[model samples]
Target: MAHIASLSQLQTPPWASVDGQLVPYDGVRIHISAEALTRALSVFEGVKGYWDPASETFSLRTPREHYERLLRSAKLFHIPVDFDYPEFLRRLEQLAAELLVRERDLWFRPTLYVTEGHWGEGTRATLVITAFTQQKESGEPMRLGVSTWRRGTDVDLPTRVKSSANYVVARLARIEARRLGYDDAILLNREGRVAEATGACVVALLDDEVVVPPSSEGALDSLTVRILERICHRDGLRLVRRPIDRTELLAAQEVAIAGTISELTLVSEIDGFTFPVDGVLARLRASYLQVMRGTEHLEGVEMVATDAGRALVTS
Candidate 1:
C-alpha cells in the first residue's frame, strides 16, 4: 500500500495549468467577482493516478472517461470547453510533466468554470487543472450514518451532472455527520430510498450478491461503481442494481463506498449497525488496485503513463 499522507501534511506543487498554459501555482488566479464564485457555475472531475513501483511509471486510470464526463457536465451547465478532447488531454499531460510528478500517487482536479463578470448565462468558460500528491488515510473501515437531508431529484438538479452547486447538499450532511462523530453520511432520496454518500456511490453485500442503487435514484452515474460491476462480472460475482432502503442497508452483510478519491472504502458501521470486513470485499478491493495500477487490464479502461509522467519518473 502507498503511504498516504493527510492534505495538510502534503505541500502544494510549484506549478498548475490554467487555460492550457503552465504557470506557478500561486500565479494562477481568478477574479474575486468571477461568476463561478458568485453563482457557483462550475463543473469538475476528480481523477486519480497511481504510481507503479514495478514499472516505474504513473498510471492514470481512465482519463478519457473522466474528460468525457467533464464535457457532459459542461454541456449541462452551459459552460463551453474551448479545446477538444485530444487538445485538452495533451495540455493536462504537459501540466503533469511540468509538475514533475513521479513516485507518489496523485489526485487531479480539472475544473471548468464561468469566468465572465456577469453572473447569468453565456459567460466565458475557463479551465484550470491542478494536481496534488494523494494522501491515503488509514485503511480502517468508515463509520457512516443516515442523514436526515434528502438528495435532490432530477427535476431539482440533474444529479448525473457533477456541478459544484449540487455538492452543497452533501456538504451540509457531511458537516452534520462530523459534528456527530461519524466518518460520513449516506443520504436518502425524497422517496426514502438509499441515494449515496456525499461524494461516492454506496454498495452492499446482501445474501452473497453485490448490490447498488441505480443511478435513477438520485445517485451520480459513478465510474467507480461501473468498474466494480465489470470486476464482478469477470470474477463471477453476482451484481444487482435496485432501489435500496435504509433498513436494508442496516441488515446488509457488508457495505462499502466507491469513488474516484475514496476508492473502495468499507463501511464498518451505519446507524450503530456494524459489519465485518469480509473476504468478498477484500477481493474486490484488491482487484480494483490491480486494475488501477495496470497489472490487470480491462477493455474500455486505459491506464497509461503520460510522456511527461514518464520523464519525471525517469528523472
Candidate 2:
C-alpha cells in the first residue's frame, strides 16, 4: 500500500462548524461519558466531498440528507447530542476551504458521542469531525464473493442506525473474505436472503428490473439507494423489492452496489463466477455515472449500457 500525505502534513485551511465554531485539527478529541462508551452510545455519518480544480470549488452532494440521517441514527440509538443541521453544513464547507488544497476527492466523517462521567453515567455529548483525501474515485467495478458468515441479526443489534457496534460484524466478514482473495463480501440475512456488502448497499438486475432486498432483509436504508431507485423508476425499469437468494445473484444479468462512498459500482464477478462486463450492469453503470456527474437527465425511457461491450461515458 502507498501512503498519501496526511492532513497534518498540509497547511490547515480556514474551517469552522455551522455555528462559526472552530475545531482544532491538531488536537481535537472526543470525550465519551463512561456509560455511553460502555454501552456504545454513538451515531455517525459518512459523506464525500469533491474538489473541482477547473472551478476551484469544493462541492458536496446532498449534505443535508446525510446530516438528517445522522440525526435519525442518533435518535434511533438513544444518543442525545446538541445538533444543528444548517450550521453543520456551513462548518463542513468552511473546513473544506481551509484544509483541502488540492482538487482531490475526500471523505468526511462526523460522529456524535456521549462521554462517560462519574457513577457509570454519561456527562455530555461531543462531536468529532475528520476529513481525509481520497486518491481514487470509486468508479471501477469490484469483484464480489458471497460471505459464508451471516450478517448480524437485527434482534441482536440494531442494524438500522450507523453505529460503531454494527461494523464489528462487517469487519470480521469483509476481512476474512479478503483473506480468501475476494474484493468484497455479500452478507446474507437470517433467512439466507441477500443483505448487503461491507459499508454498501447491494442491488441486482434481474428479470429486466432492478431488484433490491426489501428493508426486511436487515439492510441499512441507504440514501444512495433511494437516489438510485428514483433513477430506476424514471428509466421505466421495473424496480422490485424482495428477498434475493444466492441463486438470484448467479442468475443476475448484472450486479451493482450503491453507497455514499462507493457510489454505483458494477460487480464484475461474484463468487468466482464472472459475469460478462458488457451487459445490463454496464448500462446501469453508464447511466448512473451520467446522473451523478449532472451530465444527462433521465426523461422517462432512456438508453443505458447493459455490459462492458457497449460504449462507456469516459472522462
Candidate 3:
C-alpha cells in the first residue's frame, strides 16, 4: 500500500504469509466458505511491536502469548491453522524487523481464518499473518462518550474469540461516536454495564481503586489489560474487575483505555465532564513507557533491547 501523507505510513512485511506459505502482505488469499465468509467466520489478533530508540531494535510485546490467544480464538471459532508455534514466532520476528521503518511505532497483526469448507453453517479453516505500521499519536488526551450500542454478548456471537465479525458492530459504534464528536465509544454490556471501548479495554479509577469490566461482561481478553494489571500491582494500586454502571463514569477520578494501537491513553472528558490529564492513567502510561523501553520488565514479559551494532537475528 502506498503511504498516504495524511495517514500513517504502512508497508508490506516480508515475513507475512497466507495458508502456511510466505506471500506479500496483501497477497495472502483467504479461502472462506461462502456461508462463513458472508457471516464473518474469521478470527484475528491485533498486536503492536515497539522500536526502542536506545536499543534501535523492534520487539514484540508478547509474541508467544499473543499467538496463544489467537490460537484460542481460532479454536473457539472453529478455525484451523497448520503451523507450529516456534515457526510462527520466527516468521513474525522476521517480519517485524523487515517491516520496521523510521516510524516511531509498528502495528502488527496475525489472522487465522477458515478456508473453503462448510461444516454445517460455519467455515473450514485456514491461517494468515498480516502486519503494518501506524504513525504514533502525539501525546494528547481523548474526550470519550458512552456509546448507545451494546457489545455483542456470547449469546449473540462468540465473544471469547477475537473474530473479525465481532468488530463490525464496534466499527460502526466508533464511527457513529466520532460523528457525535467523540474520540471513541465505550460499549456497555447487555446488562448496561460499562464493558470496554470498541477497540480497547476501558480502565477507570473509582474511589482510588482500579476498575475494569470482567471478561464476563463481554470484553475481549486484552494483552494490554494484563500489562496494566501488572503495572497497577507494582504501583500498589488495587485492581478490581467488576461491572461498572454508566454513572460510574462520573465517579471515575481517572479514565483511560488500552489497546495495541493506542497503548495507554488518558480520557480527558466524557459526555462533557472534563477530566484531569494528570492522574493514575498518566502514571500507568509512564510506567508502561518504562517497561517497554527496557528500563523495566513486569517480571515475566520480555523486552527487546539491542546492544551497539546488534540487530535482531533469525534463522
**lDDT scores in order:** 0.82, 0.67, 0.72
Residue 6 displacement (Å), model 1: 8.3
- lDDT per residue as tens, model 2, 104-196: 656677777666444424556566666666654546667888888787676777678888778777877878777987777898987888988
**Global local distance difference test of model 1:** 0.82
Error of 3 at 172 (Å): 1.6
Provide TM-scores for the models.
0.93, 0.81, 0.88
> Measured by TM-score, how close is model 3 to the native structure?
0.88
Regions of candidate 3 where Cα sits further than 4 Å from its true position: 1-15, 31-36, 120-124, 136-138, 304-315
TM-score-better candidate, 1 vs 2: 1
Indicate which candidate wins on lDDT: 1
Ranking according to lDDT, highest score first:
1, 3, 2
Model 2 poorest 10 in a row by lDDT: 306-315
Arranged by TM-score, best first: 1, 3, 2
Let me know the TM-score candidate 2 reaches against the reference structure.
0.81
- CA displacement after TM-score superposition, residue 72 of candidate 3 (Å): 1.1
Cα displacement (angstroms), candidate 1, residue 290, comes to: 0.8
Model 2 whole-model lDDT (C-alpha atoms): 0.67
Give every collision pair in model 1: 4-136
RMSD of each: 2.5, 7.6, 3.8
